[model samples]
Target: MTRTYRTLDVPVRGGDLRVGVWEDGTPGAPTVVAVHGVTASHLAWQLVAEALPGVRIVAPDLRGRGRSNELSGPAGMAAHADDLAAVFAHLDIPAGLVVGHSMGAFVSLAFAHRHPGLLARLLLVDGGLPLATPPGLSGDELVAAILGPTAERLSMRFPDVAAYLALWRAHPAFAADWTPELEEYLAYDLVPDGGGSLRPATSYRTTLEDTVDLNTGTAVTDALAALGHPTRFLTVPRGLQNEAPGLYSPEHAARLVATYPAVRHERWDDLNHYTVVMSEPGARGVAAVIREELSALG
Candidate 1:
């Protein structure tokens, strides 16, 4: 899966933001803009991008993460969607499919609401629908459960990039699935702090704000109901049970499908939240589903 990388500086409300475009496949091919989750960069879609050879993939490191750190403003879904709109304008992308994961899903949904004419369809991977905070679960507890080792790794300051990579290498999630692509992806998230130590690009405050805003699920529900374009909801079995049981469950998804009127819902039984777009087999399956939906659109 060889790729050509180019840095794009998109002008937004506050300042210019950098987006890394991994151009693959043919020119003028239908584009798929890949949006990653909170605390994740463009690398989150490495495997998925590799599998989709027929599509021209445009993945951006969202504001406050990856190459877009200099472009800071508000860190909400609406702002993120606006950043994406700027990316489309800079690239001259008329209209194509939009694929979003986790927080990226929220951004895509918001983008759909704000700029419906910019996207032909949307593929929301484990996001886009309303998420509920579990009963008896504190906000801190929910963050710990959903973010897991990634949060811990982000909190620690590594003495060097090598040390940071070592900690990432030992993660349980990547132990069996580690690849060169994953290594490169991890490298993009680390930055040198003043003390000759590396840290995650995302600030703790940014993460905290996103985690505490789960109660605003009505906004996402309203966005979904307002969306007139073709939409697909891809669910991961594990996160559906662990993070927000009521909201992510199959029954809830079915109800959402009924409510949305235009949404197409499906469940991928084997993959977890991260693996659904990060691993080869999982990405291939997801890409296949997207290809099917895109084909149906034409």
Candidate 2:
């Protein structure tokens, strides 16, 4: 089924938020608010949108990425959660399902904690559980370790969008699975950096702030402790670079499940952090899980 893709700017406290709405031209379908990863835009969920036909997908370019880059932010999990709530309010969503990927999952947890009555069910893809940091790493080291190339690419400059594509083509994550959707998502990430160059719109500083808070601060921690919404969590064995063990190691994931009994965790060995929602098979798997979770709730 061909989906209608519409871009809109929803007014928030900081300013307007750029959102991507995908649906089958149906007016009253169930809405799923999708929040993207730390440095990613809403387009990251294209495959998921396509896989879930008839579902109204509301994906927002969070505070400092894509077109929302201009919004001056007090950026963090709670802040992004508030921004999502604002989008839901503007769309007249009293209570809805939310699908969050990577850091977006943490934001969703914060959202559920802050706005308890607004979320009926929650899905966390490749993240949201408390991350187990190595003992020796400090702030910058930990951020660099966690994000790797996803963080490094922000400061790099390219002569053209094609050059940026070339770099992404070489990336371990998208090398084999590159699709038109993924290409468009990468293309939308670029903004002019002067000198006939292009750079990612994701603010490095803002990403750093979010990384610190979500990893160590009280907002997400406190929220996780009190998260009462029925939640589904999916994770992969690979990291952003398509390397093994991903964000949550097997041991860490085990600890997480033991700690948060409400979060139903599942693992897909074939997918990575980026591929879990962006790629075809991964999206279909997630969409099925979402459908099953929703159906079970009824």
Task: Indicate which candidate wins on TM-score.
Answer: 2
lDDT of 2 by residue, 1-298 (tens): 5688999999987789999999887666788899999999999999988888878889999999999998975899888989998998888875868889999999999999999888889999988888888766666887898998788889999898899999989989976788999999999999998678999999788899899888878998898888888898888999999988989888899989999998899888888999898889888898898778657656
Q: Which stretches of candidate 2 lie over 4 Å from their true place?
A: none
Q: After superposing candidate 1 on the true structure, give the runs of residues whose Cα lies further than 4 Å from its correct spot.
A: 1-3, 24-27, 135-142, 214-218, 240-247
Per-model TM-score on C-alpha atoms:
0.88, 0.97
lDDT of 1 at 180: 81
Clashing pairs in 2: none
What lDDT does the true structure give each of the candidates? 0.76, 0.89
Error of 2 at 205 (Å): 0.3
Residue by residue across 1-298, what tens digits does model 1's lDDT show? Answer: 4566667677888787767666654765677788988888888887877777767678888887876766656677777888899999988986878999988888898898888899888888988777655666666676776666556666788777788788766665555677888888888888877787888988766766565553353446567768888888888776522343423778877777777758778887766676778878788998898788668768
Model 1 TM-score (2 dp): 0.88
Error of 1 at 107 (Å): 0.8
